[model samples]
Target: MSKEILTTKDLHLYYGDKEALKGINLNFDAKGITALIGPSGCGKSTYLRTLNRMNDLIPNVTITGTIKFKGQDLYAPSADTVQIRKEIGMVFQQPNPFPFSIYDNVIYGLRIAGEKDKEKLDAVVEKSLRQAAVWDEVKDHLHESALALSGGQQQRVCIARVLAVSPEIILLDEPTSALDPVSSSQIETTLLNLRHDYTIITVTHNLQQASRIADRTAFFMNGELVEVDQTKNIFMNPAEKQTEDYISGRFG
Candidate 1:
């Protein structure tokens, strides 16, 4: 059995007076991809942010829950948010690469953390880009502006930036939604390759993408998890009628 790396219990989030997440309970295995699928405004993205305290950036955002990472309470008063984020890096929906050279973008986190070793940074940049499956495409253009790459390449570079920090977990929110089909497929392939080394959690609207890359699938509707199970089971034999309906296109 895969070891559990993250868990949430009775997680609730409120943006001012409106409840965004209602009593969520989920756990992620140490390695493999778990996809969160739901309609728009179903809180999948919001819940994803909560895992790394990304929601804390919003004003009037209130969270009440116990989120544990390797058995450590993530929201504990003494928990180091910076270290938590380093261990659990995030890639946003759009490819939001900084306007810097690809090499600089890959090593931005390390530089911020006071790493000034030229040789080490060079090695990390190459390794990270290789891991993100973009080294062959960008190895010769390391000093080129990241924005100069195609949309899909930029997303992969962003993924490399996260991997450069050697994070144990990667959170992706609609990572391929902005790309063309070919780019999206490339990103999916890269994610599949990364599953062996990192625990990946992603929020996506594409059911086909979830079936393609996710080992497990969680269906959310109206701020609650309708069902969660192995990808095959969720797609072929979901226990909840709501899940069945959504997957069958009976309702969204």
Candidate 2:
């Protein structure tokens, strides 16, 4: 693998002539947390989505420059979108579980990827659930409706769903924004464990959450990537004053 697991060079994104991300250059090391923090509409989520080509699903969205994973351009015409997405899974702000049982929810990704063997699916479900740290709570109730799960459990279920596909990088867009304090802590602990195996890139409006969980941090303002460095440096003594201002709650 390359020294940089993921890289974006001069990336510019436009949603029908409205520039959402300015020429942004970024790089991610292997199996570490990189948090994108900014105010609302600063393009934090937009920048995160572009990494895995999630923006491809939208209409009239144009992207420029190169986004590479392991030295291969992600936007090449011959690139496989489905395969790209599978390798770089995403969890959203809201925990949107499918209308199915807990067991089914974890296996949905495998099933869609054409894994039909019952033994393999079961193993994956168990491994992924364990990885997401929700297997024990819902193990006895695997057959119960996913909708019956509480907001936090449902979010972990979503995380398990993403893990089942064996993604190399996980993109989280405010994964804990909808949860309570306890639920937020649960997700944070889970993410810390996940960093051992998966490269995590998260976009969060909460500065404290970034401080707690991120290995490195990037700050964005008005669609421009302002500062990126170690989480401690970015928060404690930011190279840019804007980062200090944001974290200090002087201005968002």
After superposition, the stretches of candidate 1 with alpha carbons farther than 4 Å from their true spots are none
* Model 1 global lDDT (CA atoms, 0 to 1): 0.96
Instruction: Assess each prediction's global lDDT (C-alpha) against the native.
Output: 0.96, 0.93
Candidate 2 lDDT over 47-133, as tens digits, reads: 899988889889999999999987889999999989899999999999999999999999997887788999988898899999999
Please give the lDDT score for candidate 2: 0.93
Give residue 59's error in model 1 in angstroms.
0.5
lDDT of 1 by residue, 25-114 (tens): 999989999999988999999999999999989999999989999999999999999999999999998999999999999999999999
- Report the C-alpha displacement of residue 32, candidate 1, in angstroms: 0.4
TM-score of each: 0.98, 0.97
44: Cα error in model 2, Å? 0.8
